[model samples]
Target chain A: MTSASPLSRLPPGPLLVLGYGNPGRLDDGLGPAFCEALRLRLGGDAHRAGPHRMTIRDAFQLNVEDAAEVADHDCVVFVDATLPGPGTFSFEPVTPSTRRAEFTTHSATPAGIMGLARDLLGADTQGYALGIRGGEFGGFGERLSPVARCHLALALDHFTALLPRQEGRPTVCATPIRGEGVHHD
Target chain B: MNPVLQTDTERIVIEPVTRVEGHGKVTIHRDAEGRVAQARLHIVEFRGFERFIQGRPYWEMPVAVQRLCGICPVSHHLCAAKAVDLLVGGESLTPTAEKIRRLMHYGQFFQSHALHFFHLASPDLLFGFDADPVDRNVLGVAAAHPELARQGILMRKWGQEIIQATAGKKVHGTGAIPGGVNRSLTREERDTLRAPVSHMLTWAREALELARGYTLENLPDVGHFGDFESNYLALVRADGAMDIYDGELRAIDPRGEILLQEPDSQRYLDVIAEEVRPWSYMKFPYLKPLGPEEGWYRVGPLARVNACDFIDTPEAEEARQEFKGLAGGGPVHHTMAYHWARMIELLHCAEVIQRLLDDDDLLGAELRTEGPRRRREGVGILEAPRGTLFHHYRVGDDDLVTRCNLIVSTTSNNEGMNRSVTQVAKQRMEGVDRITEGMMNEVEVAIRAYDPCLSCATHALGQMPLIVELVDEGGDVLDRRARSGGS
Candidate 1:
């Protein structure tokens, strides 16, 4: 509810943009798509350490081992695609779950991941989840649906807007990098 | 192992087994006298790769098969590519092509093994298997040993980086072609990988030490946990050195004596036969020569360690020596040893990757070569992270695939996994009226030793359902729980 920049209030440590989902599947790729867009807009310096430093990674899905990586970071953002939501995107703060985490298969829940980060590594890493509504997620293709693309644009705008902003230098989020204006149904 | 009980009793079903890579369950039957009746690890997911890939072109086999599972896509990609290579380039590959493929495979081993040990199995090893299920995961391991957990993640990340450097992407890259790779490694890519060589090796050594310590602590109880004697199968080089990327099929008896060592993977049909069960979608693969019941053999890390005479890599060989010493010159029948063998193989992967990085051919100009399709049918067999994987294909003259038969590593270990569960169940659950969650986890711990990738084995996509239940005599469910799991 606070208008403060999420990046500015974070503990002094590296920021991580963890994108996880099946890129091979259509709309499920929104996570990586968002990360790729962020990388392009932020330039190569995004990987380097600085006041605005951030690490970007993409995986098919979250695994148990990701907890340690998440714990190492001072701040973490989990990007994923959800089945078409009432809203185009939903950004929620993550808190460790008290319910015992289940190690089932390859995937771990975002809350489970955060819980592991906090409980296991004794990390105070603040976490947030950006769930972008996905239109299509079941096919074997990397392209996003039109509606999903629109949601991705909005999610990117909201994500970049939360980052520590600098004066004079223009932000890519201010303008459409894909040359396509965000669409509304 | 106890015989199946004929008396009426209760049944405890741990369905949709958790933590492993697929959909499965552990069922423990109790007899009238409150004794353990029978236990089985059932893989319920159906595999459709053989049917769906019928119309696809032979060239697309590598990429098409990689989509079967998100984990270990490189194994499928590289194995399928080799089979495709046989169709295009006879028995041998060009020097550069062979080295690059091997390099990629070593990377696959490094990543997959690191994942299994650090993320999957270490929770059980570091924290006791009976430890709170909530705290028995990578996160839990991290909480307990932060340094080791970080090392495991970094090691796996390095492995993925190697994959991305060689292939185009980390998950499912299209760098591999029929006769060779899509391109040679760039100087920058090579340097990036080279910088972490020593650090990776150091981390691997530390991991090996940790595994060795665990193995030593559990050695006394190892014989009681999934300790069933059976045949072992793996791919070994001509000299019987452990070879994961490419080699001849080798089968050894419980006594560690060679039973059958064949070079041609195409002749696999003559020796191996698949049996179907009404209860599970997974096929029970057995040695045809021995016939179904007596033919079942174990594969994966344990089998490979048992079947091979020695590991070629120095560090791995040393570790192998320490591992085999536990058995006093016989195959290690202890299911728990799978973790030890896996860690040893992990060392070998890092060593092999480091060795491959030193090869100049990896940076060669000639990335691919083509030849006429001399054969209509080709079989690619490699030691996948879990076990020996077989990819057989029959192509039409037009180059489209007519038939596809895949025997994944998990499928090969199907019978053994069931036996292991039964063994553990019989040992732990005997004379118990009720089954607790911790008791059920013991059965799962046995199956976890195999590290079965049920999705890959059954070719079932999406989330695998997991259910644990307690059924009273006459098969009425008393208690049940389910989890939708995907990884």
Candidate 2:
């Protein structure tokens, strides 16, 4: 494991996993699907009640109010589906964006929320964006695409291995499986 | 960004208007003499949700329709629930169910208005329209007026909490069921929400003052910004009091003459008609009697304030009086007054929420009601954050929805928004040597006044960036400039 990267050393404080996208739209449900998989993998209440102090939330899209919830946490992982890219998934750290020149209440970016938390709410919360590659986003349906489902499984496996294992759960990896870092913008 | 022209007659297209909800583009055509000839707001995206929900079971409507919008899903949720109430013979809900629904609706209004004013519209009002783009957003508001920005965040948070308490969750809540809500507000939830009422009301009042002061202080410029006389429509109580959750339809002309007033929600089709234009995906809804050309009217905050006889709440009623005085006893046709009117409604929602929280019915055991007979067809109408929203459905004997038609707030204001763009285009773009960022924003400001939610109107989803293209008279592209992200 490379200690030079922030992802190598997880924050000891409270961590929030926020999965936001329109679940009604096909493939867009990858974020919530990841959260669901993480929850089930961690067992009932293990993610939240465990020693890691992690919280999971699902939303249609990030908005202005999310900053408040994000501010209370030491770190937040914003998960969403992305168009076809170089890999199955990309996980990268995010910083407060100084170039966000406009505001839309309907949707907000992870960096934008972090910026709001730091600037308006006086918070120093760290943020990360996890984009799972998906094949379809053009229609409305509850189910994810077949390829997106495969990517989701791979993403869940890769992400859960990085988490602190539960008492009864299987062994986990201490380092990331891949080093491909992609920005969600 | 580069500005260059190649022809005397050309078209300027502002694709994906910023700051407002959904993806929309504006096209302004100039004549040979360089005068603005025509301006049209085109809704580029379309989601046939009305057809998408046709075969679904009637019971799934309240939950299914929430997918139409992410910003105001509660509005769609409650409106569809109201329509489904008729399908299941539950039009007359129990006191508890009605009050709970009212509380949820008010929470939507409060949070939606707060977000619009503080996050979307405040930058333009605080900094002049021509201010630098870098320092003209909520962050800039945070840097300059930290306290106001904080209040905006907290106020929106409190309203979302109210939704979480009444509804099952914040996003895609299934609290409002077919006959009634699935759950009641627990005493603990009520207490948690009640504790923040006074502060919200205080903040709402301060925000109102800011909007009011801005409008009055800039009357000359604000009044003439896309100013025009058009009919206003909204739902009002029987005594003509402003009622957002439930009431009868009322439309009034610019001269304050009552154009139409129908108490029966089911008979809405008899009085209103929608005209479909080939250029835009959205339909223009007009009063049936006046026909399409003359009947295109405005809806939403400005229209609601003008259509009602009086506001029920004390503070908002007082503010309404002052707002009405601006027109000297007629409808306030100034488009920029929408911000001021929106703040008045925000304060009113706060007061209404405070009153609703004090009622014991919210904690009551009874949450559902049923009528003597079922209905095959039903129409639900309510004043959403933007304006009056209509949801109509026809159910088959098999319990499946056979047909559905929804006239979202933005769709209703389609013609009005187009007119606003035309007015602003003429004022800002005509005879201009070069098109500046400020000029583009001035046109957008007029559309922002309506606070149009294009996502709900078109039932589509997509990100929008600001793209302005100058097209020659022969449809050739002369120049193009693009800006990433929304305002």
Candidate 3:
């Protein structure tokens, strides 16, 4: 991690993991799915789990109003599915975006929201964009695609390791994937 | 491409109107004489949630339908919950259940309105209408006026917090269900929200003040920008006070006289009907008695404030009085005044939310009661953040939805939006064959006033989100533009 990265200077508290996207759209539901898997792996607690306890939330999409919730937390992790290559995912640090020209109430990008948390709410909230590559975004269903399911397992293991480990749980191997800024699983 | 003759009339299109939700295109046609011939705003995408929802169980509607639009899911959630309530049994809700739903609706309005004014509209209001396109957005506003932008973000934060506290989560919350909600408010949650109530009120007042100041500064532009007289539609209480959650549907003429008042949502079919135009996927809804031409009406904050007699809240009432006087008691026709009215509603929502939180009845144990499914057809009507929303569902004897129809706020204002775009084109781009980027941006500003959710109104399936075309009188394309990436 770079020394200038905001993620390096987080305060003491449970990390906030926010997963947002349209769950009805097949693999677009990966973000919420990640939150669910993380909760179960951390002992099935929605708000707290394991040694590095974290609060988990899932929503259809991000909005400007979400910056407030981000402000009160020490560290945040935003998870979502992207239209990139299949079976590939990236986890990159989020920086305040200065090029966000237009703002809409209905939907907002994670970087744009992070900017709001930092610039508007004066929160030292730092975060990462854990983007899992999605294959299908059409049709309304609560199931994931084949390739998305493959990436989900490894992605969950990588995120599970980021938190404080609890005793009696076996940790998965962490190996780097395809993306340049991605974490290993 | 063949070069058009200099003497021929030109067509101009602004596709993918920026700074609004979803995909929409604006088209302007010029005649042989170089005069404006036609202008229309077209809805481009069709997800068809209405058609796909046919086989789902009625109980799953509140959760399923809210996914139609991520921007205003609360509106859909509460509206669907109300409609499903009718199918379950009676139209009445327990006091606690009703109050919790009301608080959630207020949160929707506050966050939606603040997002519009501060992020979408402020850049145009603070900078000139003809300002540089790059400097005419949220980033520019932040760079020049940091304090104002910060206030907007923080205020929206409070609104979301209220949603999480009462509704369980901000987006696609399962707190609200048929007949009543799933849970009640806790004292801790109530006290936490109470602290920001006063701060929100103060900030909303400042926003209103700034809107009034800007309106005065640009009197000429405000008067003619997309200005047109039209009918109004909104929900009003029995006492004629503005109510968003539950109320009777009321329609008033252009002169502010009552045209129709239907106490039940079921009676909506008797007074209102829809006409599908060939050019767009959105349906045009109009009053049945007046026929299609004269039936197109407006909704949203402007219509609600104009259709009502008084506001029940004190500060909102004062603001409403000032807003009413803007037109000397007549309907304010200036399109820009929508911002001013939106601010007033924002204050009203904040005030009402505070009051509902203080009411100890929200903690009652009787959160919801069971009712047998007796009705096959039910209609739910309420005021969404954009305007009035209608949800009608027909279920089979098995309690499964057979048919679903929706008339969103954007569809209700379809005629008005088309008229506004035509007026702007005629007033600003009549003789010019080539328009500047700034002029195109001004046309979008007019549509932004209504804050239409094109994603919700869209009923057809298409890949392109926005496509603008300039066509000659003979239908030859003179110029064209398309916008990619969802707006």
Candidate 4:
């Protein structure tokens, strides 16, 4: 993976990276932990536009109210911890989905939120879902498992490489890598 | 699709009921003659949160317990903070502290109820319960009723802004501490919240009218759907007004006779006890005097409205009167009335918030206070959006929590949900050769009425989908149908 700054090559518009899961549950904290790492790498100027602006947020789960926030951004990447898979991580574009797969007040999928943003708020924001493989999810603890930490590092490296280059080629992965980390429709 | 024919008695199971908070399932049993024998609601996962909190420092509880449920974390946070206030001998908080906490709580109620009504419940109402699974969802609602759907999203956002301002963040906020709040609302925060009050009020009123109109228009169906007579319980102010933040315990029978009144929060154990049944992970709570069988009662919006004498807010009070008139001065046993009652409370929260935003006390500097002596044990009881939530704790001399017990709102409504499922099963599934999707949804709709947060009740986690299975008496799988999405 390239050590160059990923933000420099991204689309020139506001970007929202939301990482959500229960930090109290072991390995479930992978999302927030990844956000913390990304924030540090971006430094204090992350919120300001270098080439493009970036905002990072963490929550216990995605909710219906998040639609408004998503609408305000030009692009959004939803990061979450997935059950152990063959690959370290999987990244895919998220389009509006009318399907209500397990939709509830407590949680909403990236596709569902994107759908709400488009349908209710008339937003044209591009969306992507990034799922990092996790091993431990049974107990209540703040620390991430060792294997999950390794996967997180690898996933971060792969994500940084997947960003668009300065030539302004396509910004994100169009085709989903079929893996356990990818959520099936 | 039709269920396969079987000779012996059969059991139909609906696993991971959709649209509600967490994971749970429903099972219906049929006798040899295809008569509805019995139905049960089973909580599938268990986290043992009470046991999880033990050995932790008492001061860590308010924030620690928020991990119980992502949906109602603020409810758990405030309720735990209230309990810890007693442990620290700070039960009487400064006016500013109390108001801030109340504001935070009202924000929780507003947002939670809005989400349930607009997203979870409205899909079933807007499109009939039997509507195709593909079109029965919030997205579908948005496509059909854009304006109403927009109002729902904005209403939810407004309430969430209130929570963010008061609680310090939207998720797992730590503003509430042992003695009092961490800070008071700043002038800027106050203005930001105040600007949207009128708009929120208007939307709230419109939503209430929608629920009221639906209930009245479909009275015959709504009234009879999962309808049954039982006891009602909630936390009511001393003067018998509806008070969700803090109050004494009140339980009224189906006839509106007070069975238990003005019981201290500390005496909750004396008034109610939980009975463990072998079939499910959730426990059934009942009035102590009546025993398990006869004492089981319902809680949440329906019960809160029935148990309280009147709502303090004028708009909610008028709505409550009309809601009560549905029964001609009697308690409303109609399960579908929960949606209407929830709207009333949502409007009341908006009014109360509008009033509180004007109070100088919210901007006051006095944030916390503590008494001279400390207490070893304490109990906190408040009406969460779902129902009355109880949090109790015992602290050791070292300031570590020795024990903890949480009776979440959903646990209180467990028996009621089971009864509703049974009623729907009997009404829609009896003598049917095949259980259609519509019949399955009828059972789910009954459980959805209570808005049970199975995650909060069991302290577990999972994404739920609708799965129905048919099994013979010998536990052999006869047929199975599964849906990718839930209710």
- DockQ of each candidate's interface versus the true one? 0.38, 0.44, 0.42, 0.45
RMSD of 4: 5.6
* DockQ measured for candidate 2: 0.44
Tens digits of per-residue lDDT for model 3 on B170-209?
7678878988998888888888888888889999999988
The residue pairs in collision within model 1 are A106-B487, A107-B487, A120-B143, B15-B467, B16-B466, B17-B24, B47-B458
Looking at model 3 chain A, report the run of 10 residues with the lowest lDDT sum.
A176-185
Q: Candidate 2, residues B1-487: lDDT per residue as tens digits?
A: 1123235668888978888888888888888777998888988878799998989998898898988888899999999999989987898898999999999999989999998999899999999898987888887887889889889999999889888888888867888997888789889889889998999999999999999999999999998999899999999999999999999999999899999999999999988899988888899999999999899899999999999999999999999999999999789999999999999999999999999999989999899987765589888899999999999999888988999999999988899899899999999898876788899999999999999999898865677668887776786766777887576
True contacts kept of each: 0.51, 0.51, 0.51, 0.69
CA shift at B35, candidate 2, in angstroms? 1.0
Q: Which prediction has the highest DockQ against the true structure?
A: 4
Q: Give the range where candidate 4 chain B is weakest over 10 consecutive residues by summed lDDT.
A: B1-10
Candidate 2 overall Cα lDDT vs. reference?
0.85
* Top candidate when judged by TM-score against the true structure: 2
Q: What is the lDDT of residue A131 in candidate 3?
A: 83
Model 4 Cα shift for residue A89 (angstroms) = 5.2
- Between candidates 1 and 3, the one scoring higher on TM-score is 3
Candidate 3 TM-score, C-alpha based: 0.90
Q: Model 1 — TM-score against the truth?
A: 0.88
lDDT of 3 at B108: 81
Model 3 bad stretches (over 4 Å):
A1-14, A46-53, A84-87, A101-109, A137-140, A166-185, B1-9, B370-374, B459-487
Candidate that beats the other on DockQ, 1 or 2, i.e. the better one: 2
Q: In candidate 4, what are the lDDT values of residues B1-487, reduced to their tens digit?
A: 1133245679888877888888888888898667888888888888699997899998999999987887889989999999989987798999999999999999989999998999889989999999986778777788899888888999989888888888888878888998999989889899999998999999999999999999999998988899999999999999999999999899999999999885579889988899998777799999999999899999999999999999999999999999999988778999999999999999999999999999989999998888865579988899999999999999898888999999999999998999899999999988877888888888999999899888899966666557787776776777788875444
Question: Candidate 1 on B1-487: residue-level lDDT in tens?
Answer: 2134243777776766777876776667777676776777776666787898998899998888998888889999988998888888645777777887888888888988898888788888877878876677676666678788778877887888788877778888888888888877877788889898998999988888888888788778876888888999999999999999888999999999888988888898988999987767788999888889988999999999999999998999988988888889889888888988888998898888988898888889887887765788889999999999999999998889999999999988988988888878888788766667677778888888898898898765566456677667776777776655531
Query: Clash totals for all models, in order?
Result: 7, 2, 6, 0
